[model samples]
Target: MTNEASRPAVDLYSDTVSRPSAAMRQAMAEAEVGNEQAMEDPTVNLLCERVAALLGTEAAMFLPSGTMCNEIAYRVWVDRGEEIILEESAHALHFEAGGPAALAGAMVRTLKGRCGIFDAAELETVIRAPRGHHGQRQKLV
Candidate 1:
């Protein structure tokens, strides 16, 4: 067996494994940082505006990570006791560690799909119809 020290340093664990490149480091150094939550940061406001324009939305808020983005979206769009449909191996379900249930009071219904992708027909099969108090309302996918 190879020694641990001799193993390649490439980490395949997550998207955040890489350090910022020189250009990114330079940009960060030059950035005009401010309190973003106060809505007074000029650089953040500009980035939000640009992203909003690109996505054709009214506005956007730059979040620190995808997990925060998912949590926020779940809080906004999902009601308590509602269900979100997803593949069994979805990051929201597995990686986020039941954040939907803890944060949004939401539940998940998973589909059997290859590589976290499910077809529309498969989605249709699992969707809970809007009926009186039988199952949780299907909110987001």
Candidate 2:
């Protein structure tokens, strides 16, 4: 008993649908897990250290999800009531449930781009000089 509609032509919807290899599952089962907040997680600490070394950074912090990373980046780069330019098809804009606005108090200005990447001309069009106190400050892209 099978239904053709039960499966999709291309299943790129989410990371959730993927299954781990046997070795990966074994590694997870044997992993030394601890509290990330207290920096007691040896695995996380090692991963961060290695990533930092590879990226030529002094230190690195780990975030579990892309959504959290985006929020953290928004907080770090843009202040409240500021603006961030994103492509119309960006995950933070659509999938994150207005995280740019709600989490960081950011004003989002989306530019329609080819394959989610906008060019300089498109960018130049949206960017405005500080209009007035009433106008939003243009921040990160």
Q: lDDT of each structure?
A: 0.87, 0.89
lDDT at 132 for candidate 2? 93
Residue lDDT tens for model 2, 19-53: 77899999999999999899999999999999999
Identify the runs in model 2 with alpha carbons over 4 angstroms from their true place: 1-14
Model 1 alpha-carbon miss at residue 139, Å: 1.7
Q: Please name the candidate that would achieve the greatest TM-score relative to the true structure.
A: 2
Q: Candidate 1, residues 1-141: lDDT per residue as tens digits?
A: 869897559854466767888999999899998899999888999999999999999998899888888899999999999988889888888888789999889988998887677899888888766877977898899
Q: Please, what is the TM-score per model?
A: 0.81, 0.85
- The TM-score that candidate 1 achieves is 0.81
Cα deviation at 12, candidate 1, in Å, is: 13
